[model samples]
Target: MGNAYYKLNKIAESIYYYEKALLLAPNDQEIKTNLSYAQNMTWTL
Candidate 1:
């Protein structure tokens, strides 16, 4: 779901979903990495 939002260029939504996912699996490296990507996107914007 997060990835879908990311691909759609919905950075806020992607970050929201990624944060939600992180709550469930805090140690998930992929989610962390993806969330980092989304955050970086925000910085670029």
Candidate 2:
């Protein structure tokens, strides 16, 4: 769900929901991937 948003270029909202998801599933791989990608987006900007 959240991953879709990031891939759609909705960075701020994606990061918001990703942060929420991380709190619930710290070991989630998809979340990690999204986070890594989002962080890279941050660095790029």
Reference-based lDDT, each prediction? 0.98, 0.82
RMSD of each: 0.5, 1.5
Q: Model 1, stretches more than 4 Å misplaced?
A: none
Which residue pairs in candidate 1 have backbone atoms (N, alpha carbon, C) closer than 3 angstroms, thus clashing? none
Q: What is the lDDT of residue 24 in candidate 2?
A: 99
After superposition, which runs of candidate 2 have C-alpha atoms over 4 Å from their true positions? none
Q: Tens digits of per-residue lDDT for model 2 on 1-45?
A: 567888788877788888889999999998988887886797676
In terms of lDDT, the poorest run of 10 residues in model 1 is: 36-45
> What tens digits encode model 1's per-residue C-alpha lDDT throughout 5-45?
99999999999999999999999999999999999999889
Using all chains and alpha carbons, the TM-scores for the candidates as numbered come to 0.95, 0.70
